[model samples]
Target chain A: TQLLEQSPQFLSIQEGENLTVYCNSSSVFSSLQWYRQEPGEGPVLLVTVVTGGEVKKLKRLTFQFGDARKDSSLHITAAQTGDTGLYLCAGALLENAGNMLTFGGGTRLMVKP
Target chain B: DVKVTQSSRYLVKRTGEKVFLECVQDMDHENMFWYRQDPGLGLRLIYFSYDVKMKEKGDIPEGYSVSREKKERFSLILESASTNQTSMYLCASSFGGLHSPLHFGNGTRLTVT
Candidate 1:
């Protein structure tokens, strides 16, 4: 089975602090996606990285897909309280697998003002 | 903007009861998915449909079944509700392809007593 393992299951930091969360797996994927979920809501897609070694930025958030397509990372620069949420990484398998996704255990981030 | 709407925000049911959770998407996407979220496990896919009347088992489909009789609607069914099945159920939709991002609904929190 394809599995994505996320690090630092919980994080609490003051506003303006920086943090990085990682998603790793032994199996290679065709693409990687990051999502953020708030309390009482389903996850919303934040970014998707399709090419190996690709990096995508959305305001203060930076997402990176590893060269081998087996890992990914999300980094926040100067995190604000608004950035607090559960961050999830999902790996999408090849087309033959119907492009199905395998999600990692989430990283819950709390940014205090 | 894509909107995925779930029928219920919260539900309470007794053990051994049959339950149905409904979801609809306004984007007319060709793919829909059902997932369950727990405290530690981020999100586990239960079922998915790529077309009307077509269903596929996902990673954790043991306690659940799904129906997709219409293009814009997907339903998740619990034949026999159990305490272990209590979770936050999420509904998502996406255009059929390799790189499409999923649009999600506000989840339904189901409690089995």
Candidate 2:
């Protein structure tokens, strides 16, 4: 079974602070994805990084896939209350997992103003 | 806009009761998934379907089962609801194959009392 380990299960920071959440694994993946979920809602996809060392940015969030495809990071700049949510990382592997996503434990962020 | 709708936003069931959660996607997606979200456990996949009546077990499928009688709809059934089974249920749909991001429903919060 593929396991994606995410660090800092919980985080609390003031608005405007910058933070990074990480997803690491011993196995390489074909692609890695990041999602943010708010209360009472399912997760919304933020970014999909397929290539190693690739970086994608959305206004205040920057996502980077490690050079080895075994890790990823999400950096939030000038975070706001709207950025507070549960962030999850998933991986698509080559082991014929049928494109099923293996999810991480997730990092729950609380941005207080 | 791709919209996935779950039948109920919140539900309460008694232990040992048969529970069903429904999800429908307006888009003609080929892949559908069911996941459970807890406070610290994050999201755990329960089942997925690539086509009608073709269901695959996900990471955590022990006490839950799923049915996909149609492409647009997927249903999750709790044969015998347990207290520990109380959690937020999420449903998601993806138009394309692997590497494509998923569009998720609002989610169903099931509390078994």
Candidate 3:
């Protein structure tokens, strides 16, 4: 079975700090997606990277897909209180399967003022 | 914006009771999914449908069943609710494609006692 492992299960940082969350997997994926989920709400898609070594930016967040399509990363620049939420990474194995996604354990971020 | 709507935000049920969770997507998406999220377990897909009346079991679908009678609506059913079934249930929809991002609802927090 394919599994995605996420690093730094929990993070607490002060405002204006920079942080990076990593998602790694042994199985290659056709695409990877990042999402941010706030308390009492479902996850919201942040970015989707389909190419190896691809990078996508959304305001203060930067998402990078691994060269082998087996990993991905999310970097937050100058994180603020509004950035406090759960970050999740999901891998889509579209080569041999449908558009189903396998998700990683989320990283909870707490940005304090 | 794509909108996915779940019928309930919270639900409480007794063991052995039958439960139903409803979801509707306004984007005319061809794919609908049901997932359960728990602390430290992230999100596990329970069932998915690629089109109307087409359902497939996901990673964890042992105690769960799904129905997609229409293109815009999907339902998740728990044949016999148990304590272990207590978790946050999320419904999502996506336009069928290789790299399409999923649009999610606010989720239903179900508690089986």
Candidate 4:
């Protein structure tokens, strides 16, 4: 089974602080995706990285895919209360003749003002 | 904007009772997915459908089944609900592609007592 492990299961930081979440796996994936979910809502896609060593930025959030395609990271430059949520990483695997996403446990971030 | 709608936001059921979760997408997406989220397990795929009347088991599919009779609607069924099955169920849909972004519903929090 393909498993993606996320570090720092829970994080609490003051607003404007910087934080980074990591997702690691031994198995290589074709692509990696980042998602954010609120307490009572489902996850929403933040970004998708397909190429090895790819980097994408969305405002204050920066995402990077490892060169080996087995890991990824999300870095927040200056965290805000609005960034408080569960951040998830998913790796794309080929299964049953289709692309399937295997998600990590996730990092719960709480940014206090 | 893409919108994925889940029929219920919360559900309560007794053990051994049959349960069904419904999902619909207005974008005519060909791919629909069902996932369960737990405190430390992020999201685990239960089932997915790539087209009408076609279903595929995901990594964690035991005790769960799915139906996709129409292009926009998918249903997840639990023949005998158990306490362990209680979770936040999320429904997602996306256009067919290698790296298409998934649009998700608010999610259904099911509690089987």
TM-score of each: 0.97, 0.95, 0.97, 0.96
Q: Please, what are the lDDT tens digits per residue for candidate 3 over residues B1-113?
A: 99999999999999999999999999999999999999877899999999999999998999999999989999999999999999999999999888889899999999999
* Most accurate candidate by lDDT: 3
Q: For model 2, which pairs clash?
A: none
lDDT against the true structure, per candidate, is 0.92, 0.91, 0.94, 0.92
Candidate 1 residue lDDT tens string, A27-106 = 88899999999998888989999999999999999999999999999999999999999999998876445757888989
Per model, how much of the real contact set is kept?
Answer: 0.78, 0.82, 0.80, 0.80
User: In model 2, what is the error at residue A89, expressed in angstroms?
Assistant: 1.1
lDDT of model 2, residue B96: 63
DockQ of 4: 0.83
Q: Is the docking of candidate 3 incorrect, acceptable, medium or high quality?
A: high
Off by over 4 Å in 3: none
Pairs that collide, model 3: none
* lDDT tens digits by residue: candidate 1, B4-113: 99999999999999999999999889999999998778789999999999999988999899999999999999999999999999999999788778889999999999
Off by over 4 Å in 2: none
lDDT digits (tens) for residues A2-113 of candidate 3: 3999988999999999999999998999999999999999899999999999999999999999999999999999999999999999999756568898899999999999
> What is the iRMSD in Å for candidate 2?
1.3
CA lDDT, candidate 3, residue B74: 100
- Residue lDDT tens for model 4, B10-102: 999999999999999999898999999988888899999999999988878999999898899999999999999999999999897887888
